[model samples]
Target: MTKDTPPPPANTEQMNSPSFKLAVQDRDFLLSEPMRGVRFMLEYSKAQILLQRAKIRSTIVVFGSARFREGGPNKEPFWYEEARRFGRIASQLGGALCAEGGNHYHVIATGGGPGAMEAACRGAREVGAPAIGFNITLPHEQQPNPYTTPELTFNFHYFAMRKMHLAMRTKALVVFPGGFGTMDELFEILTLRQTGKVQSLPIVLFDEGYWREIVNFDALVKHGVIDSADLALFRFADRAETAWEALIEQGLDVSVGENDEDLARDM
Candidate 1:
């Protein structure tokens, strides 16, 4: 040996350097706050691709509490059963079973957690209809229910993206008794409708007494904050079939991809 040459280092600094890692494979780099916009886009694009491939032309989104159980406390069982029945009814009559031009309509969509979501997904599966479960990452650990179609089941990191997906294809909305999360979703749709951000969507709140007691739309009208005409934004229903009828009366077309609106907005 000439003894003039220095031995190579024990480790390859180039291989271990963050700069050497591919940007796509660098989790830390992707998750950094500076990359928030990229993360949002990633979440949006992934769900969009899957939904487009599934041919989910429109949806009858069901919102309710994950805490309400089949045989839980009083009225909770009724709410669960009603949500399940509503899911079945929507799938059966909303043209989800019959696709037109390869597009499915009125497919049941849920928050993809338990309680009413599980019940609704269960009902759709029983009818051999595909159901979408938009599960979210939560502090308490939310998991997708077994009843949602495996291919259609999706987990979302951003609530905004999840809500956008939920709103995008929705032809009608049916909300059962719920707590804070449920109210948030309900109010979100209401605000969109109020501001004309979305198409005129038929909204049905199950359990008329409960919804009336919880949210005083009448009070909002009385206070002059919202016009009395805004009261027509949503209707109260006491039964699953009633909700379906309200949706139909409000112009819920059971056809495929026929809405005058664009099927999916690029934004």
Candidate 2:
């Protein structure tokens, strides 16, 4: 319209700029409702690729309360120490710490928050084995503990996807004292085993006193809610050594070389 104005620059068009790119740079489009399925695939694919690359064939998932910090509550200290001990034991004897090259079986995995989760990751660290943390985004912004392997730590926005990753490669599940989240994961795996959705794996509930007092499995059988034989799906352990032995008895393959003392260092 103005005679004095020069022509627009050749590369100045908005569509040609990097900011207008839709595939990778458009965060708003990625978060849109229609993109929910894409988000789910992204969460699944990212974890799957990394795990395969790391040769993590199997995982030992640990579930517990995020509130159970060391020296914080009545049973917190014991639970924290025992969980840590079990981590070390499992990692060392379950072929995670083996020098020979092969699939890393029974590697420690956790919810990637504080408390017993931290203890489990810490246990894997003590044995110089990698641990995985499937951390979920929360209102309070839960973070992965320091002991989780830096390359293996994962963040998830969807609980369903996070739970899927937890169960997909799990060879065993060790439940310590926890509240709602722990119980949810425990029963979920048990249901999977019950329904034959997942092959049977060792499920151990640490601290027999706490679990027995909290959940009356016998009552469930007595009420005809669950069959009496269903109780055989899991076992109880009062200590770290006992928990490891129970896992072995339940068909966990332990390496022959490592001793209890060698695995229980810095305790």
The residue-by-residue lDDT of candidate 2 on 1-267, one tens digit each, is 498998888777876765678676788778889999999999999998998788777788999998988787688899999999999988988877756565677799999999999999999999899999999999989988999999999999999999999998777889999999999999999999888887668899999999999999999999999999899999999999899898889987565334334322311
- Which residue segments of model 1 deviate by more than 4 Å? 1-11, 99-101, 257-267
| lDDT per residue as tens, model 1, 164-207 | 98988787899998999999999999999989987679999999
Candidate 2 regions off by >4 Å?
Answer: 1-5, 9-20, 100-102, 255-267
RMSD after CA superposition, every candidate = 2.9, 6.0
User: Per-candidate TM vs. native?
Assistant: 0.92, 0.89
With a 3 Å backbone cut-off (N, CA, C), the pairs that clash in candidate 2 are none
